[model samples]
Target chain A: MNEKTVAVLKQAFKEFYFKNAEKIITPIRMKEREFGYMSFDKVMVRHLSFQTEGDLRAFLIKEMPHSVYYSCAYYYEPTFAMDEKGWKGADLIFDIDADDIPTRCKEEHDHWICKDCNFMDKGKRPDKCPKCEGMRIDEKNWVCPLCLKATKDEAIKLMDFLLKDFGITKENIEVYFSGGRGYHVTVERSALEELDQLARSEISDYVSGIGLNLESLGISKRASYEKMQRMLPLANDSGWRGRIAKFFSEMEFECYNSNDVKDKMIYIYRKMKHKNFENFVGEVIGKLSTKIDAMVTTDIHRIFRLPNTLHGSTGMLKRRCDDLLSFDPFIDAVALGEEPMQIFVDHSPKFTLMGKIFGPYKSERVKLPLMAAVYLIGKGLAEVD
Target chain B: MGIEFGLEDLAKYPFMKEAGDYVKKLSLRVEDLGQEDYRPAVERAKQRVMEAIQKNYISIEISEPIVELLSFPLALMLVKAMNVEYIIHRYSLAEAIRAESLLKEEKKSIISYIFKSTFNLEPISVKHELFDLKIKLIEYLKRATHFHEPEWKLINRVVDNGFVYLKTHELVRLIREEIRRTIYDRMKGVSLPSMPKNLKEAVHEISRVLPPRSDKFQRVTPDKFPPCIIYTLDLIKKGQNLSHYGRFLLTTYLLSIGKSVDDIIDIYPRSPDFNERMTRYQVEHIAGMRGGRRRYKVPSCRTLATHGLCFKDKILCAKIRSPFQFGKKPLFKKKSTGQIRE
Candidate 1:
């Protein structure tokens, strides 16, 4: 009823509850890395359709072959509604064979990926049921660069940075397991109306922008068809999130960025402090949405010059924003490479006038939601603790 | 006056931003664009003179200084053939530049009409040929630019008319020769010395090697939604990378040829190995190459497997391949650069 955005989460969920009150809606958290392979050693393919029944069936058959479960995919807004084009989502990924996709992978395999020296081959895989000659083999387990356990610590630290930076508090933040392999940290839409699209994206960019020697966060420009398959929703990942945690645990949080947070925030003792982002974020609250394009541009005019933003159109081509339609944030997740890939959507997840979290895309075409980003940061934080 | 647009204005275009710091890019293509900046000024001058109904601006007439002056025919030609927005692309400009170069360098008249015409800019023989081409080009632009969002289909009309204009004089022969040379020069830069002796032979070689021209490519054009494979094919032969450029080229090419990767792989058995290896490079280098060339610089085992060059440092190479992870590779202490090209 008002001009400002109000997350009728209570209302929306209540309505969802009324429609499917007999059903369940679990907040799923996930943090995955693109393994870069499809079912049976081929590229993965995810089907996208304008028809609800057809696409849902296809996705169920392919991605959830062992299980018949589906997450809330990008069904609303710009991505799903655009020109109705179908794509074979594949991302050529190099899987980190570090810890069998998990830190707690007790069944036995390798674990650990190094973020500092770009060291992927870490930990020991026992041969013949014991530690194999792994201590010497330094760089082999690289299947899941994005969610490898070691880097999650760095990933989560950035989230903490954003929380304090954006003036977001725990009461305002909600975390969930992505039902598969990641964490989803959600800040109520009502709480975040203060941040503009660019500000929100900068937060995304910073978490992802943090570079680890082994592999950087987000999608690669040269992602291949086969690579897209691993990220495709059609090819399911059963244990990817665990692999991400293992990687995070292995890497001791090393402060590489001059402004990056180096430790965890403990809410129990009120010993919560994110070293880097508090200042800038505190200054930006309340004045965000009202800032206007001119003001935002003036504030972060340097954004137009960042290497990624500069040649953006040619790198990641998407529809020109000419309407109010939003790209269901889930669409980007569905299009991901089984990891936290940054994405951008011109409008909000619901095609709301206020554009929200749309980033960490697996490819230039994919646009992940803030929900996935939240999980990634949450998992990243949990790893630190 | 300074060109109204700054060099940075190139950034606003889709491809230029990736082209990177405009002043430093080393390509004839960039130079050609620079020359194009002269067009708007030239257009304003022409329009002002037309409105004045005046004989000259400073010392030059609205349409004179060429050996022969046929204002009516020239204006009519412009209205007929070209689209102002699409313009005579660089290839055509190259044609125009080359032609002008010939007249001055050869010490001979380009066409007989220029010597006997009403006024003079240069003592060239082929003033009529230049005038006719310019007129036709401008007229074509008038129609093309008039419709802000004209269908790409109109390109066919322009090309059809353009072809007709090309046939009017000896210009056709010169263009063919220039096109042949341009094609040859590009290939010569890449194709091994053993490949071809001259331009004609080179064209024949590439035409023969690639899949045959189907009706789709022969007739398909920009007007069509899915453009012909020829445009992309042209980009590759012009020197885009085999991974980035090659993928886009192969996708459209296979689509046009109606062939699948499987079909091509069958023909080239080593394709899978090559694809994985090459794609690894594409992904690894993607970070360095995001801007364009930077996206293609990723080091790979492909350098050793396909080429004799061994990429030093196994850890570094693995890190590079991190962007292209697809399961895990068996770790062997990465060996030194080995000559593995088969």
Candidate 2:
């Protein structure tokens, strides 16, 4: 960014923090927390402390940081050795990233660049840059409707699993749009407050469906030569068993045939028991299991972006999700501001925000709402006109 | 026919030799577990432990796990007698921590016993670090009843963080290992139940009847009933004969939920083995109309499972202690409005 644009952004940040300083609140056991922020040159200002929320708010307004974060961990003293830092406990958290969701949008716009050779190509990222065959490559990912929607579905699925399988009550859980490209689910039950990293990891594994014992799950092979016909039991069952049964019985793989699919699968399963039973069942589990960022859940020492705070990357609020089904990130997560500003647009896909269409423009100077302008500027795709 | 065995008799099983010898040497009363009135036996165990404590001579030869096993009934009895928040003992810090770890791993059993026995004892004196570890472990065990696959790395984190107190935690592991080996050795020559060919059906039966204990639950809702009550209601609908304990569980559970004695007795008539005079008398006895004014709390979920009666299907089965928790509060009243999560 030019010095003039950087000055404008800093001024905007200062004004916003000054007006909204009252909204920020520190987490529990505040005395043992380490605060951090991003500076203009991407320098991380860490190991910072504040006496009160008021002090923290004043610092943010004065510094006009690009973003802010507080440690998820609580300690006896903020700056102490890892072992000496009395580990109190951490809230159980799960992250679902849109970039991780497998979808067709990747082929359309996702690209990779050879960091060594500067060779760029659009489409699915290759392990090594094709032109330079360089090992050091950087993946450039962008969020689209398909990928974001898929991630939302994954998040909802994970939420259901947490409630039903992990036995977490719905009331103890809070879901938030990550303000960039996904959602974060935090569990705040007092009972779970002191769960060590290990206990939380088991929860993460269950949510991600990792290291599942197939034989114990009743996916073992049986010798059967007879013409076996069965409707996989779906009714009066619960958990994974019921889910698997319903998925197969519903014939979702065969264009929703729903007619005799269970019988056909049963026949095929019995016939192919000696050869493909394990693979088939494994495939089903992979399809059904929730894909979550395991590190987020297990890292008791992690620092999560504070909820309700603005995310510098997308210029969106890390908004709480009230209803999973109706959460539209583009509209619901947009930071509330109505003032319009003119900006030089670079490249952007056709995107919808606040029930209005914007972009599909390439390098055009255009006037847009403050939120849109901030979003474009924040993404580094546009500059102040 | 009920099987009969004394504490000494357990020595013949090989695994119980050390445990049996200690009990015999201590002159602990080895009551006939087969008997219906085992209350006096447990009371005697409590008395013996108290006597030993008074004498200042608890046998150190007995392993920590064995000591715990012997002390369980005693601790339980004492907790009820004292009605304390927890049962604490003045013992070696190492021993206490070791005992706690083994007890901690058995989450469901420990939690149910702790609640039923009302034990809330802590160690008399210890280093602050080890004390904190024990207290944290105890608190963790009390709260954790859910069955989750153990991750050793996480267990190591506790060990690493509590490095100064690692010796105590290691002793806990040693006790666990020894107990496990004893069980393995005892079962070596014993004929095990035949493995089910239809493993899926078998697993389904086990999970349905006894879902792994978890603390998670929606607040008790109007439509959601405890599994024991649901199972008993199902049995009554099918006109099946109920066991003595089952009958007691049902009567106490129903009465506690405000069901009238007449209403409870009416449901029993549908049972194939129902005797109007006998059923009414037993129901009245449990309702505290005949049996001394003392009313009984419903048996713990583990006790229900041992009798082959627990029918856990709903997630609520994981957390609740008694059917009474489902009194009037609708489970997740806030969830109905869709504002709680946000």
Candidate 3:
């Protein structure tokens, strides 16, 4: 990207924040929490704090950092030594990203070049280069509708689990689309504020379905025969046993296709012949569990991308997902300034953005919108002409 | 070690099942609970159970550990005269809520029987307890729903699946207040068989249900203390020998008023038998460090009176309920010579 392109993106970001200044907020007790950001040169800045939203807005407008972040933790003295900064409590947050959500398109349009071997290949990068076994693999990922849709599905699943199972209400939960590929879900309830690392780890396990004992839900050989009987005897029971039982009772009598039942909830109950019940439970759990970054959920001290800020990498707003089902990151999250900028496309896959299709332009000069140009250049797929 | 029993254990005890089923049906009919019509029958059963416990014959049935389960309804039977409707509802609801929380924590524990059974048994009760509770709470919410839609919706969803979910800490506080006003008041003076080890467990079952009360004042103005607390401070200044309970009340009061635990311990040296280590330990324990990790709630007016340490003017004693409620409104119009009297 040229200096002019970066300057335009910066101006666009400044306008975005200025327009949404009232919506911006630092963590509670802002002066007591450490903030971090990434500069345009990609240099890291840490140990930052703003006394007010106005102060933070002024700094963001002045520096126009690529990304902004604040600590999830409330510290005793933020600028003190790490251990010396007494950690009070933190908001429990879960991060789900498209990068973490594996899609076939990643293998189709994404390309990785090994800097060490100068070897190139399409699709997901291997840990080591296939030709020379070198570890330095630089990757280029193109955003597509299919992958974004997959990411949204993951987000929906997570929201459902949090609300229905975890008993977290919508008021306490805030879902925001990360300017990049994923979504961040934050639980801001005071009930969860004092949760230590271990307690938070338990929540992580529940959501991710890690180490859940099947026997606990009466889906094991060790489950007393009486429990198994109760599972069948009563039609109204509600745990996993009831869920499985309800699934069986609700099914049409003669579907006759084992393939149809294989992937259904009935499969777990159908396989419960006492001996292999545990295996069935495990399989069902694997299919139903929501994927999340367990580390992000468990960490008492974390920094997340600030909401309402423009993501430098995508030229998209890190907007809150009020309407997740209808939220299109391509169209809805595009940053301000629609003026097309001239750039020579290095290489890019055909992608639909802003309700229009553009792409697959190899070494061709193209005039793209300011936000689109920034995104292409950010992905290393284009440069200023 | 304590006769490892769960709600499922009630199946082995025929008599407990019979009594528990009776109590569950009786409890569900809230309108019929107010009359003393069913009191005689429950009292008779409670007497029979107490006689069995005193004779030590009930403990012999290791195969049927029904003592804990039986004691719950027995205690309720004893306190039935003290507002039966309130006690029965509070006892049943508390037990169900506690079961849900415990089952959520220790999923593999035998408490699953509590989630499975339809009867409200002794230790952990039946599966339908959650369903019953949901019906009652939802009706209460419909009559007087104070929360936002998200909170209400979450409670509805959790209850729909036959589970009760307390969405926010504030909601939990609201429930606890209801419990305190109902059950805690009724059972305050009711006597039960104290000899059976299971009696303590049964009575204390819902003890951990309340979250720790926070008395952290942003800025405590000690001069604004209620006449009673001020009287106690004056006693401390004069090196008076306050009783053990009196010392406990004072130490906790001072600590909650922003005094350091060490500072609280130091104030106790004037006492006749103050050993540094003992004083420190007692102080820390009251501060919720050495024993259960729960801070002490401020002693209410009635509790202070029970200790016979309540020194208050007629206005202070009649109007104030708690120490925290004293300085909350800034209505005191006294200029102090640092001396306060009842």
Candidate 4:
């Protein structure tokens, strides 16, 4: 971003923080959490400890950083260096980002440009550039309603795993719209806080269905068709067995004791266009498993974006969702003002903000609401006019 | 209500808190254990360590409760005094196994008492068709994390209302794991005063019979290892936690390069959660000596990248497709030097 765009974003962020300083919810054990922020220039300032919510609010009002973060982990001395800080424990957190989730809308909004050859293309970014075979590929990702809805669905699936499978109560689970293209589900002050990296990895694997063995669920490739039908897990069984069984039932194959029904189900499974039992199992796993960022959940020392702060990328508030089913990020997470502002748009796809649709403009100067202008500028698609 | 356990229970589970209370009531010091009155205890302690090392199981004989109870601590001291890592792990496992076998015959009340006193877990008894006991989910996870089987994953089990339902045998198995950890912790890092003459001789005798550490990996070239293997080895050497895939990569890479199972097992002692039996089973399974009887091949660089274990070198890694090809000389290289020329 240029200096002019940075100044505008800084001013808007400053206004938001100043007006809403008191609205920031204090994290549990605030004094034990490390605070950090990134300046508009992208210089990260970390190892900062605040004694109270008032101190944190005062710092925010003075600095008004582009983005703010607090550690998921609690520490004996929050300001100490990484290795020196005595780690108490961390809240179990899961991140479901639109970037990680594969959505059909990405082909319309996401594009990648190879830095080596300057070759640009739409759709998912290739592992390496086709023209130059270079690894430096810059991707431009825009979150559409479809992408956001996909991410929200993933977050809901993750919440299901946390609640029914892990047995975490609804009151202990807090879901938040991450203010930019994702959702964060945090389990706070629970018995899971003391889990180490390996344990947390196992939990991640369970939710994501990594390393799931078919034999454990009584679905074996080598079993005879009769035995396989007989050994199929019932829909009321526990855990993955029940999940897979329910998935099959939803596909119109009920696990009843009738010979005709069993024969029909086996016949359908066998005639799945050369997809063997393994492929069928794989399909079930893919559809039933929750897509979670395993790396973020397993990292105990990671710092998360603070709630109620403006995301630097979109200028949206990272606010909690009291009712996830009805929560709309574009409508509810908009914290910036509607004052008219003029900006020169280089190129941007059509998007919605605060329930109003804004254009797919080429190189043109247009007057827009403050929220839309700040969002476009923050995304590096616009500059101050 | 506090359940009362008798001398038989204390002698069988000498690591229990009640055993400590019994020993405290007797008020026997280190010096007194060396005296003639405690000769049988000293002898039994030597036998305990010897059985653990040579046979991998310590037999319980509660004919003499005092001797049995006293021998437990004496054996711990002897293992600590020897201060050998292999012996420490073996002895802890043997003692835990001994406790597990004895707990199998005890009633529910006794088993629950041991659970409460030793592991600080209060698993409530649940009347269910498949499961008889249910533990708090957190308590279950803390113990179950050590298990590598898919069945032990929390998602595979029956969990309801923050309690994990478990079979009696499964509960016993979890207790055995905790007992092993507790025994290992108790045996580690304690300096004992000079032992009695006979006890010192026993330690010396046991040391003579201890198996020599495997040195087969000395023939393998460490300098030629790929970056990912080198990184995993570094983590293992530093006693850090390695991911499952990281362990698999290191094991398969070593096995592919003709490292013996014993040599591979020796490499893992520095890991924080090393279990000799588990390591040996997994290593042998990979070597095609167990389960499925198909020797696994080293994963390709693409597979490594998918699992996020690839730590590729820009120049060297780009040349090889698989980690097995990492250190080998190029096929077209001349026989004189046998090295890839820049």
Q: Identify the leading candidate in terms of lDDT.
A: 4
lDDT (tens digit, per residue) of candidate 2 on B277-325: 5676577768776435477777777777888777765666645555666
Candidate 4, residues A80-192, lDDT tens digits: the string is 99988899999999999998889889998888889999998999899999998999999888899898899889888888778877889899899999999899999997989
- Candidate 2 docking: what grade? incorrect
Candidate 1 chain A weakest lDDT stretch, 10 residues: A305-314
Q: How does candidate 4 fare on TM-score?
A: 0.82
lDDT of 2 by residue, A1-385 (tens): 6676677677777777788888775666667776678876688866666778788888888887777876767777666656667788777788899877788887876776788999978877788877878899877676777888988888889876766544567888888888888998887744666776545665565556555543333333562322233214342234454566666675444333446644555555666663576677668777888888988887888777777677877778787899978999988888647687888987666777788888887889988887887777887778886
Error of 2 at A264 (Å): 8.4
Q: Write the per-residue lDDT of candidate 3 for residues A316-345, one digit (tens) a residue.
A: 778888889999988887766668688888
**Residue B52, candidate 2: C-alpha displacement in angstroms:** 27
TM-score of each: 0.24, 0.54, 0.53, 0.82
Deviating ranges (above 4 Å) for candidate 3: A1-8, A18-32, A222-226, A231-277, B1-342
lDDT digits (tens) for residues B1-342 of candidate 3: 133544545423322334467446545343342335534433433443343323312222222234344444555544443333333433434443433343344433343233224222222222542221232222323222222222232222233221342322323333432433343443554444332333333334333332222244335655677766776767776878677787788777877688777556656656666665557657777888644557887788788888876777676545667765764655675587887678
**Number of the top TM-score candidate:** 4
Model 1: DockQ against the native? 0.02
* The best candidate in terms of DockQ: 4
What lDDT score is found at residue A357 in candidate 1? 40
Docking band of candidate 1: incorrect
Clash count list over all predictions: 103, 9, 3, 0
